[model samples]
Target: MMENRNLFLAILLSIGVLGLWEYFYGAPQREKAQQIAEQQRIERGVDQNAAQGAAPGAQVPSNPAGAPTAPAVVANPGVTREQAIAETKRIPIDTPRLKGSIDLTGGRIDDIALKDYRETVEPNSPNIVLLTPPGGPQPFYAEYGWVGAAGTTAPLPGANTVWTQEGSGALTASTPITLSWNNGQGLTFKRTISVDVNYMFTVADRVENAGSAAVTLHPYALVSRHGRPHVSGYYILHEGLLGWLGDDGLQEIKYSTIEEEKSISHRAKEGWLGITDKYWATALVPPRGEEFTGRFSAVTNQVPIYQTDYLLNAREVAPGGSTEVKGELFAGAKEVRVINEYQNNLGIPRFELMIDWGWFYFLTKPMFWLIDFFFHLVGNFGVAILIVTVLVKLVFFPLANKSYESMSKMKKIQPELTAMRDRFKDDKVAQQKAMMDLYKKEKINPAAGCLPILIQIPVFFSLYKVIFITIEMRHAPFFGWIRDLSAPDPTTIFNLFGLIPYDPASLPVIGPFLMLGVWPLIMGVTMFLQMRLNPLPPDPTQAMLFTWMPVFFTFLLASFPAGLVIYWSWNNTLSILQQAAIMKRQGVKVELWDNIRGLFRRKPRTQE
Candidate 1:
């Protein structure tokens, strides 16, 4: 009983330390982080009122004045996205990863949807819409054109201008589409649009001077998203305008900040700029090595409009001589591998930065690579997670072996420790001195047991961040009721594991508290069994604290991602097996079964 009390006290002290650390440090750190985030939002001018009133799928109307204005307030003539698409004569865009059309009216690359990804995990859910036509309910699209020099008599393509398709039939990866528009003043503008198997669209714009004189014009491309879209509001994720300007590194501007600042401008030798969502992004990559000015702006009228645009230096088109400008539009999923490929092969600078790897990039990226490697080997992400947990344990085995050995030694010396306490009951200083002497004599470090746990905290957080932010984990599934590993475990205990027809999550106040799922319960049980590997505390207070730790953790982790919970449970089980083996090698008796039986056994009553 005395040995049990010492072990229980040690565990209880560890729990108390962790609890106090979280309360005094972790809580305030989180609050400070939130405050910092709030300050950043304020600095960027995130206006709640403007965001609420912003119309979706709206675009800036063509300015007849030929002067650049805020794209948000420019009223699109179409009322609905479908109506806008129907109103225009378009060329169909069909590819393995994309399905949409090229609106011939202004030769805009709009009406795009990601063919491979859906809105929900359901098989029949609609594909995610990425780009929409102008004049639609949500006006988000990309357009390329030439800006004539001031006082030039050439007419450039505006929103109302209709361009005729040079060729017939649908545009495929093999066949490119060409659009031609001729101004009566003797300038012919031809745009050839081509797409690859993935999400890249190559646009080559050529201008011919049929007139007797030369004209100077600037080639420009703009991706405008009218109205503020919904954001996940997670601090770890960035949903806004992002780009790599030459030598400027990366620039990110939130929608609200655009509204507050009106516009952000930068001059780069060459680069790409665009608006990004949590999963998808649309960016305009100008010709490399060319000098251009990039701008991100927000305009408010009926709705807020966000636009990312770049204008190249003015070029002279001599009589009968044509000048061409080549650009690429990336409108698709933020797939890390695909983006990295583009960055390497196409020379798109810092393209992989689009995916938020967070501050722990060093750990998060390698962890993802390991998990991804195991996923391919196992053919299931759930199994991959389990395999990765075992691999992590193996890597830390050396350190953990020493820690567990120390714990075993401490457990064996618990009786001596308790006797020392009794021998010095009236002198606390003597008791501590005797305990230290015994510890040094036995070569035991009481703090060694916490080393493994201390190392695991960061690894655990990094894994959570990776699972939460990566697109591969978006709809990943495990066995049974775990369909989306990134999402919280679906099966809750309150409804008797789905035996009842009610959801506890719907109840007010208690809904979240009652959301304990199967995975969490399994995790709690593993933790409890792992703790029981050592002797229990003799003191009732310490024993009760140790007993309740697992329950507390089970409820706390119920809302975490299913994959994370699975990893925790598996890690706990592995630790239990490891400690048991160590304790046996140290000639210490395992007391787990004894402790389990102790719970059911009644204590004898003492005569008063």
Candidate 2:
């Protein structure tokens, strides 16, 4: 018993020492890594400059001798002229030109006629923004507009547009602009842009046939960041259809896209539409048409699509009939609110947050929601986690109590099990069978020890899922010096040399180190106490092997989220207390050092 207590203390001391070391080393390394990343970014910029084919320190000439001169292919150049030329063929043959411009920089939502619009983005920009008459006297292309092969005329003629303010207080003159278009042959079109809404923007369009025959109109949408048009980002084709705009990001998930034949509209059922970029997404549904039906494409290839309650096809509009298409775009950081808002909009399906396969999310949503509800009541996520943890512990209390009670009963019978082992020393099988029989006679379930640990597996996984997906914890600071709960614990210690690869500044040498420091020590102490209190295994080597569990767990969790470790350590502490209570209730004296003597300090009796 003394040895067990001493082992617990020793383990705690070791963890504290490691924590101090980690704290001192974490920050500076992180700063060093950041510096390296910045350097690489600068180098990449320089490489791009070098690839532009301009003479060293000379300005690029405005015009080439004839067509633009292709840069000579340098060794190992991955980009090719054929690739660029092939991409051009994919551009919509009937692409339209810009027709109008709006400058709301002065805190006013005033419209500049389409005639005054200028091209702000290059033709090859990932997103193609075209402006043509929504519905006007004649189709006119604005400055920097080019005609495409389809001859559909960039903007359909005779379009009427309406613009109105949205939300309160002018935050850069917010507006919801709607444009109504009519093709003389009886094709009616309406497109709306909901913009400047707290970093979110949306564009939706609808088309209806008014003539006797059905007409086919191709539907296309392009989106990009306001200023950073070239950076590859994630986007959702539909509410749940998540995908990457570029190949730069792949989270090893499944997604879907629409077929090309479905891109053309002739008016059909009224349903959902969606698309995803590298990081964000958009979802919408269009109303039925009168004569012709339209198809809504939900394009993506990274995340699964959660189908909307609305129909997927536009309704067929009859002669002198119409259709309505509605859509909402969620543009923001990859936060939970962004995802939840998108899921709630227009009855779209929610994206299931996944981790370690789907098991964690599949098991934790109910528990997480419960935690969230209580969090709302108390107004604190941390406290909510604590409450949930307590609830979980209480729920398992009966089983745990039974297990400990059985364990105590087994400890009391250890002398008999050992005696059987000695009697059957030469026959291992007989020894094991005798023990099994003894357990059966004693009404003790040998497997009881596995119950608590088995239950912990799911609980641990669920907690991990919640921590990984919940945006409520993002940047939510805790008590003193612990900022940014979403990130690793920031405890820094400077190293004279770059020996350990971790950051130190933001992680300064306190928070992370202390977290790692105290929890593992507590875990080790609890584990030692538990080992001392429980019945020992028959095999001395096996028992020693089991004793390493705390050490292994500490190492495994060294860099995990600090909050999770805190919960685990607290849980272990509670378990220890529970076990101790069980022993006291049964009037089982631990007998500390005396128990150690009876167990380990005995010499084997030899008889010849």
Candidate 3:
């Protein structure tokens, strides 16, 4: 009974963790906001001084040293991304992993699509659009250029500035494009944008002091989104603006938080800032070894615009001397290896943080990497998960063995313990002391029974985090009828695995619970069997709890990722076998079969 109580406490701890996790991540907050009128939307620029009546405006950064400001937002009643792209003169960008174009009007990397990823698991599904031109449904793009220092109005390149591309070929991994704009003054701004085989884009801005009164200019880069992006409303994954500043550590500001505050600014020697989705991101890495002010700001209109930008320190371009500042932009799918490579090779500060590894970064990332390694070796992610689980069990085998051994010893002495309790029924303190004495004499640790359950909590959550957040698991397949491991199991028992062809999840109220899938059912059954391996608790409330927890979890976790459900079910099965083996070795009764039969057997009536 003590052992059962300890187990019960450990299970409750696990449940508490899961409940808290679900409470924050599983629910969305809906806020009521008024829509800005069409005229107001058109009038709203990045800042008050930003030009509002320009013909072709770009998404401008706020207080950009009074540089060429955003062109007035022309409100087209029904504007599509395609129409927005057509409006701009673009230099084609075609790479192995990415396909997009640079908007020549603003010299912004506006239109980008991930070539290796799709909007859906279907092969014919459209490529995942990462960046889009302005005035579209989701106006997202990265712009890099030079802004004049405080009092210098040098007719700097702004949204309306038309840059001249030096070469005609499409921008590829090997081919770099240079867009140059002249101020008709001394400064000639040339931005050469180059991309790697992966997602990193290197933008080197060179300013030529031709006319030559020494001038001061600040280099700036920004990622702008014209409308509020549809986020994956989960606390576990940050799907808004986040960055790692030099001294300030990491700052993650949600869209709503940013809107409320208007702007968050940090002056750092080195850092990166960006807007991130669950699977994709676009970031601005300021020039290395330079002090810059990074700001995340939003302008709330009917359709809000969010921006993350950095303005580097003033660079004094001497007469007849040129100044060059090189920065990088990461715009693509957040693949762990790729992000890590850029961080290690190019020395981007805390760039891997863009993936939102959560509080368990130490455990979660390694778990993901291990599973990924096994995936490469086995050629199947599901097989990799199983292999990793076995490895984890092996690694913790000694601890588990001792824990089970203690549990088996405790179980074997249950008769003596029960007798002791009955003998001391009138004195509760005496009962506890005698039990402690008995346990000490038997060399049994009552807390040892909870060890296995305690060990499971972090590992379980780490695996969940890896599966839920990693891009590698996004469309990974397991076996027949199990595709997209990151998504919930699609085969729901309520629909007889789709034989009925009616969507049970469409119903209201109980609709979500009704979508209980096959893997969750298997997990529930394994959980039930695992619990039945132990003797039913003598306390009726505890017994009832032990019996129904599996069902409760089944309903609760039916909507979890298929991979997590698979891991949980597999882990439970392994634990049962391990416990049974230990019990047999310790000369304790393996009551699993007896417990199963007892559930069906009828008890004779005592008194009529």
Candidate 4:
């Protein structure tokens, strides 16, 4: 009982420390930083809706400092996406998992929509819009072009340069499209774009110089997002500009950070850089083993834009000479297995790092694969999670058996322990020594009960990270009323489990506190039953703490993902059953029913 009390106290202390730290330190710091950033943005005249008014066919204007610039022609207000697509000539993009168009002007691969995903879980919902063309309500696009040298007279492709399609068929995995432009100064440029069945687009740019003098130019690719997009503002997940620079590892910069710093530069021999949202990402991969400069910048203007760009070394084309550069763009969901395949087959460095797997990558990634394997076999993620929990329990069955057996022995010797404690009430050191002797004689480990719990801490945290960060868990359904595994359970007791007609989540202060869902209730019940496996603590304070722990945990886990809560409830039930069986086999009477009866039984009146 003392050991149990100590463990409970330790757990409570840790929780209190974390709660106080988050409320007193972390939340205030984040709020203050956000306020300062908002003030800075206002001082810079940053218009949040400036990107909505960008003109179609507007290329990133080159600034003297080499930062991205707003459109030369001001965008007309109230222009819709349909209007923007209609304003420019485009080549249709058809793929198994994507649908959109490639803008002919400036040869940008913009206007992309994810076919496999939707904006909502409802059937027939609109497909998720990943990228939109310039001048659209939200301008997010990827553009590849060349920059002319300081003294070169060659007219490189700019915002207004329109390319003529050299082919007749639409751009598909099997059919690539080639666009050509002639500067009329004896310089001919051709861009051939090819997309795979997935989201990768390969761009091959060739330059033929027929002029009398040699020309020097630099090829560059950029993934630019005009205006800041909506973010979940979660500290655990990163949603902004990020990239994998070879040997430099991963570089993640928030939009606000970019705005404050103006720009960030990284030199790499070969790498990929891009802008990342919570679910989708757009990255540009330069040619392998090629020296390049990557920059993440926020260009402040009428329509401020955040850009992830890279410029390769200059290539000189002499008279009647030609040069070609090959690069690739990844625009789609950040699927773990798909990214890993690209990293292995295509030699893309650290592509899997795109997902925020957190600090426990070793445990989190393997746990994801284990769950994924079962998901394939079971055909449902919810069922797979249950099976995974069972497997984990089975794996630690031996250790848990030992712990439970020790606990049963301790319970059987409760009378002897109490008597010893009374005899040594005035001698604390002697009591501990005698207790240790008794433990040795009984061949019992008083601390054994904590082993299983300690082992579960990392596994629990890793599973949470996997479920929260992986795209596969998005919109995944369990049985019913749980459409999205990444979200908390929808049904709350405050509305009588949806039998009533009110939303407690909308209330202030106490709203989130009242969100005790069905699964959390089930979990709390299981936890309470598990605690009943041992006799109730003798001390009044200890008994009260033990009784309230389950209720505390239930409310604490109410806001977690439904899938996680389900796992916890299932795991606790299994533990209770296993402990009961073990206690019976050890020839010890289980005190669970007696404890429950004691809870409701009327106490005999004292002779006052």
The numbered model that scores best in TM-score is: 3
TM per prediction: 0.86, 0.56, 0.91, 0.91
Question: What RMSD does model 2 have?
Answer: 13.8
* Candidate 1 structure lDDT: 0.80
lDDT of 1 by residue, 219-297 (tens): 8889987657766555666788999898887887877778788777788986799999988999999999999888887
Please give, for residues 512-558, the per-residue lDDT of candidate 4 as tens digits.
77889999999999988987776556666666666778888888788
Report the Cα lDDT for residue 73, model 4: 38
Give all candidates' CA lDDT scores: 0.80, 0.42, 0.82, 0.81
Using TM-score as the yardstick, the better of models 1 and 2 is: 1
Backbone clash tally (model 3) = 1
lDDT string, candidate 2, 1-608, tens digits: 21233344445545654563344334434644564565456445535665786322211111111101111111112333233223221111110211223322111111222111212222332332221121111111111001112333333322112222233231222445554544467776665555432323344556666677643333322221110112111121112233221112212222222322212222233233333322333333332231212222222111111211112322444566665544433333334554555446534333322111234456676666876787789876666777788889999999988877876666667678768867998998998788888888988876676566667767876776566445455544545444544444444224322346654434555634333434445556666655555534444554555456556566546555556666676777788788778878877666444434444644311111
lDDT of 4: 0.81
Q: lDDT (0-100) at residue 393 of candidate 2?
A: 93
- RMSD, every candidate, angstroms: 5.9, 13.8, 4.3, 4.0
Question: For residues 439-496, could you state the per-residue lDDT of candidate 3 as single tens digits?
Answer: 8999999888888887888998899999989999999999987889999888889889
The TM-score, computed over Cα atoms with residue i paired to residue i, of candidate 4 is 0.91
Candidate 1 residues lying further than 4 Å off, grouped into runs, are 1-80, 425-429, 536-542, 597-608
- Clashes per candidate, residues 3 or more apart or on different chains: 11, 73, 1, 0
TM-score of 2: 0.56
